[model samples]
Structures are given as C-alpha cells and as structure tokens.
Target chain A: MTIDWNAFTPWSALAGGALIGLASALLLLANGRIAGISGILGGLLARQAGETSWRLAFTVGLLAIPSLWLLFAQLPPIHIEAGYPVLVAAGLLVGIGTRYGSGCTSGHGVCGLSRLSPRSLVATLCFMGAGFATVFAVRHLLGA
Target chain B: MNKTTITAFAAGLVFGLGLLLSGMANPEKVLAFLDLAGNWDPSLALVMAGAIAVGLPVFTWAKGRQKSLLDEPLKIPTSNDIDRPLVVGSLLFGAGWGLAGFCPGPAVVATGAGELKAVVFTLAMLVGMTAFQALQRQPQPA
Candidate 1:
C-alpha cells in the first residue's frame, strides 16, 4: 500500500485536532455540554424551552465561520465527489444513523474516545469498519 | 445571552475553525483518508489522536464534577449500552459518510460558505433527521 505523501498533512491535522479538543473541553467546562454536532442539531428539533436559545446560538456561531474566515483569508476548498443523488441518499443515512446510534464522528469518535467510554469504542469500531467496507466496495467493486 | 450561551457560541466557532484548519472541512481530504485500499492518507489518524490526547484528560476531570465552571450541570452522556441500535445506526452512518465525504460538521461549515453542494446535502440531512423524529414517535410493533 502506498502512502499519499502529497495529501498527508501531519502538522495542520494535529493542530486542528487540538483546536477541536479545546472547543469540546471549553463547552464542557463552561456550558456543561458535549460538543457533539449531531446532538446539538438534534436538540434544535426537539424544541425544549430554555434549551433552544443556547443551541441556536451555537448553530449561529457555526454559521458565522465562513464570514469570519473570509476576513483573514480565502475559505478552504470543499471537494464533493458525490453527485446530488448520492449526497441526498448519504445525507439521509447520516442523519437517521447518527440520531439512532446516538452519536457520530465527533460524538463517538472524538469525545467518546476521549472519555474512554466502552460504548463509544464499540460505536466507533462499527462505524469505522462499515466506512472502510463501503469505500472498498465503492472504489474497488463499483469502480466509482 | 448568558455565560453558557456565549461560551457555547465560542466553542462552536472554535470547532468550525478547527474543521477548516485540520482539513476536515475538505471532503477530498476526508475521502482520501477513507480510501484505505487506495493511496491512503494517514493524516486523519493523527487528527483523531491529537484530539483524543487533549480531550481525554479534560473529560476525565469533567466526569468527577457535578457542575460546570459556569455553574451549569455537567451533561456528560451516561448511557453504557452497546446495543443493536448503536451498531446498526453507526454502520448506516458510516456507509453514508463513505458515500459522501461530508459529515454533519463539515457539511454545515461548508454550507455556511455558500457551497451549493453542501446546501443540498444539509437540506437532505435535515429531512432525514426530521424523518427520524417522526419515526421515533410511532408506536412500537409488538
């Protein structure tokens, strides 16, 4: 197996990852909340009074990123390999799946692993395995 | 906004920026990492490790606390079950992630950037989420 040297970015990845960790840590320390994007979004739909405002604010802050980032530099490139059909199907699966599973990459992968929750570990393994298999099937078998 | 609200906003901003800086916002980078059988990019591994390294200690400390520094209830997840829902749901989520490299975080970030593709994906994701909400309210078949 060949490593994609040109695509590999260790420093930025680590630094960015640390920033994500800091965000999660900050949320926990200050608001007593987990920085799970799916959970945050899901909570928005439930419409619980006294809970809606903070969740809305957090979402607004996320929406504010592009404007904020554009102030200093150009926004990063976002390459989408999938077409609309795939995107729609994928989006549906992701939404339903994360909610049903109770977490996603951020929840299960980053925060859950950090806390060393065995359940998160199991969730992580299942998702990662499925992801690897899906990619293999798509790239190698379907030849997409 | 209260202290909690402000901090949550700040945290979201930081998280969004981290996705941008760490290459997580870039679907190509994520796809490259996921493309295991191909020329694999191992950078995402370091990303996960770096996040966990910083997060582990903070979580461990938070676990012992009942209240946050801002006087809010510490809301760490308490569920320990590794059940059918978790496995099935995660597998479905993983397949979707593999099909399209956009996860919720980066998709929202990109949608904020006015990317049309992200717009489509996010809308569909919301619809799917709404469907889940509807399905959840249904009477269970015995």
Candidate 2:
C-alpha cells in the first residue's frame, strides 16, 4: 500500500495530541474527573447525577471554541466526507455505542489505555479492529 | 463557577482545540487514516501515541490517589470484567467512526464551527443518545 506522504503532519499531530493529554491531565488532577467527552455529554441527559454545573460548563467551553479561536487565528478547515444520511446513521451508531460501551475514543482510547485498564485495552482493540474492517469493506469490497 | 467547573471548562477548551489542531476534526483526514488499503496517513497513529505518552505518567500517578488536588474524589473506573456489552458496544462505535470519521469530540467541535453536516451529525447523535436513554428507562422483562 502506498503511503500518503502529502497528508502527513506529524509535528502538529503530536502537539495537538499532547494538548489532549494535557486536557485530560488537567481534568484528572484538578477536578478528579475523566475527560470523557461522551460521558460528560451523556450525563447531562440523565441530570440526576447532580454533576450538571461542571458538565454544562465543559460543554459551553467546547461550543465556544470556534468563536474563541477566530479571535486568535483562523481555525483549520474541516472536511466531512459523509452525506447527511450516512452522517445520521453513523452518528446514531456512535452515540448509542459509546453509551453502551461506557466510553468513546477519548475515554477508552486515550485515558483508559493510559491508566492501564485491561477493559479499555479490549474496548480499544474491538473498536479499532471494527474500524479497520469497516473501512476495508466500504472502500475496497463495497467500493463505495 | 466553582473551581471544578472552571477547570472542566478549561479542559474542554483544550480538548476541543487539540481535536481541531490534530486534524481529527476533519473527517476527510480521519477517513484517510482509516483507509488501510488505499493511501494511508499515519498521522493518527502518531497522535494517539503522543497522547498516550503524555497521559501514561499522569494516569499512573492519579490511579494511586484518592482525591484530586481540588479535593474531589478520583473518578477512575474500577471495573475489570470484560463483558459482551463492552465488546459489542465498542465494535458498534468503531463502525460508526469508520463510516463517518466523526466521533463525539470532533463532531461537537465541528458543530460549534457551524458546519451544516456537522450540525446534522450532532443532532442525529443526540437523538441516538436520547433513544438509548429511552430504551434504558424502559422496564426490563421480569
């Protein structure tokens, strides 16, 4: 398989990843919480968890990022490949799956792996394997 | 806002910024990374490694602690049992990710940027989550 050399951006990827770690670290060290975005957002739906204030605050911050970034520099361009139907279906799967699994990429992938949780490792493997398989099916087999 | 809330807000900001900067917010970039047979972009692997590298030490330290610096209880999950639900759910999540290349964090961030497709995905995701919640609230068969 040929490598996509033009798309490589190791430095920025590393830096941005470090920033994510920093964010997770800050949440853990300061607030004693996992920076699991899905968990945070899902908790809001429940509401009886009594962690509304912090969750809302975190969400507000996320929603405010574009406006905030525009002040400093233009945010990088985002390209979505899926049409509305695929996006909706995919979104449904992600939303339902994350809740059922108890974490998403952030929770299980980065933080769970870091914490040396076997469950997270298994979860990560399952998801990653599924991801690879799905892509192979879509791009190669189905040829969509 | 309390310190915890403020700290959470700050973390959210950093996390969103990181997603944007790491190119994870761009579904096309993510899809390229996922495309193993086609032209592969290995940047995502580096991103995960970089994140885990920085996270490892901090989490190791946090794992030993009971309370955070802010005096809040450390909220690490203690469940070690690998269940069917976990595996199934994770596979589903991955399928969705591979299908759309937009996960929760990046999707929300993109929605914030007023991307119309992102808006659709985010809304659909919320509906999906709400559907899950509804299912969860239903009475189980005795």
Candidate 3:
C-alpha cells in the first residue's frame, strides 16, 4: 500500500500513544481505577450518584481537550465515506458491543491489558481481530 | 483525588498526543488505509508498533511491583475463554470501525484535531454508549 508522505504524522501518533499509556499508568497509581471509557460512561448511565460526578467530569474533560487545543493549533479537515444512517448505525452497534463486552477499547484494550487482565487481553484481541476482519471485508470483499 | 483517575487522565493525554502524531486522529488518513485500492496508508502499523514496544516494558515492570495504589495486587484476568461476548463484541466493533473509519480513541482525539466529521462521530459514539447502557437496564439473559 502506497502512503501519502504529505499526510504522514508519525510524531503526533507517538506522542499520542505515549500520552495514553502514561495516562493509564498514572491513573492507576492515583485513583486506583481503570480509565476505561465504557465503564466510566456506563457508571453514569446507571445513575450511581456519587460515582456520576467524577465520570461526568472525566468525560467533560475529554471533550474539553480538543477545545483547549484549538486555542493554538489548526483543526484537521474531515471526510466520511459513509452516510448518516450508516454512521448512526455503526455508533449504535459500538454502544451495544461496549455493554456486552463490559468495556470499551480504552478500558479493555488499553487499561485492562496493561493490568494483565485476561479478560481485557481476550477482549482486545477479539475487538482488534474483528477490526482487521471488518476492514478486510469492507475494503476487499464488498469494496465499500 | 483517586490514583486511578489521575493515571487515566495522564494516559489519555499521552494517547491523544499519540493519535495526533500518528495522523490517526484524521479520518481521511484512516479511510485511506481502509481504502485498500486507492492510496492505502499503513502508517498506523508504525503507531501500533511503537505503542507495543513501550507498553511491553511498562507492563513487565508493573507486574513485578508488589502493591499498587489500590492496596492490592494488580488484577489480571486468568480465564482464556473465547465466549459469545468476545466474538460478538469484536464483530460489532470491527463493523463500526470499518463503516466509520473512527474508533473511540481517535474520535476523542479528533476533537483536538479540529475535524467536524470527527466531532460528529464522537457525539454519535457517546450517544451510542449511553443507549447501550439504557438497553442493558432491561433484564436480558446473560
């Protein structure tokens, strides 16, 4: 596969991954909780009073990061091959998967795996493998 | 206040930086890789490789540490069962990734990347996360 040299941004990617890994490590040290998005967000949905505040704050903070960045940097352009319906459906599916999986990629794939949770390992493998397969099918099989 | 939250936030910051660096926060770049026919980019593989390289060492170190901030040993799942949840969840996640070219990490990172489409994807993904929780309220067979 040919790469567009102009579009490459490996430095940013490294910085981002390092940031995520560091965050996961420090959060464990500081709060003693896994920073899995699904778990955090799910706790809010269940309306578990005291837990909701931090979760909300965490999520809000997540949204805030981008806003904060906009102060100094230019935002990237966006393009989607899928339609609104497809986008919505895909989101819904992800939501359902998170519930069933009991964690999103952050929690299971990143935090869970880091902690050496077999569940997270399986879940990460499952999700990542699925991702590889789905991309293959969509791009190669259906050519969508 | 809690150690976990502190660590999580830190990890997220780094993760966001990684996304920014990898060009993963960009939908067009991700789509190109998925394109397979057009100019396919494999830059993401390098990002994964870098992450694993760092992660492997960190994880090994953490494994040897006796007590964590939680006052207990790090919890690692022992089961290797490949159950329905694993299969179904993976399929769903992959499907979403393929269709949207956005996963949760980059969707969040995209906010910083300043992409309108990523914003939309992130909002929808949040809604979807919420919807799943709502649905789970019903008593369904485990």
A40-65 per-residue lDDT for model 2 (tens digits):
88888888565898888878878888
Provide the TM-score, chain A, model 1.
0.97
Clashes of each: 0, 0, 38
lDDT by residue for model 1 (B13-75), tens? 998898998999888888889889999999988888888988999999999999999998898
lDDT of 3 by residue, B1-142 (tens): 6654444455455556556556666666776665555576666656555555555566666666556665644543345666887667766776787677777767766654566666666677778777766676779986
The runs of at least 3 residues in candidate 2 whose Cα sits more than 4 Å from the true structure, single-residue gaps closed, are none
Candidate with the larger DockQ of 2 and 3 = 2
Q: Estimate TM-scores for all models.
A: 0.98, 0.98, 0.78
Poorest lDDT segment (10 consecutive residues) of candidate 2 chain B: B124-133
Candidate 3 chain A TM is: 0.88
**Residue-wise lDDT of candidate 1 within A1-144, one digit each (tens)?**
689999889999999999889988998899888888888888898787877777887788788898999999998788888899999999999999989999899999999999999999998998888888888899989998
How much is B61 displaced in model 2, in angstroms? 0.5
Candidate 1 to native Cα RMSD, angstroms = 0.9
Q: Could you give the CAPRI-style class of model 3?
A: acceptable
The per-residue C-alpha lDDT of model 3 at residue B108 equals 64
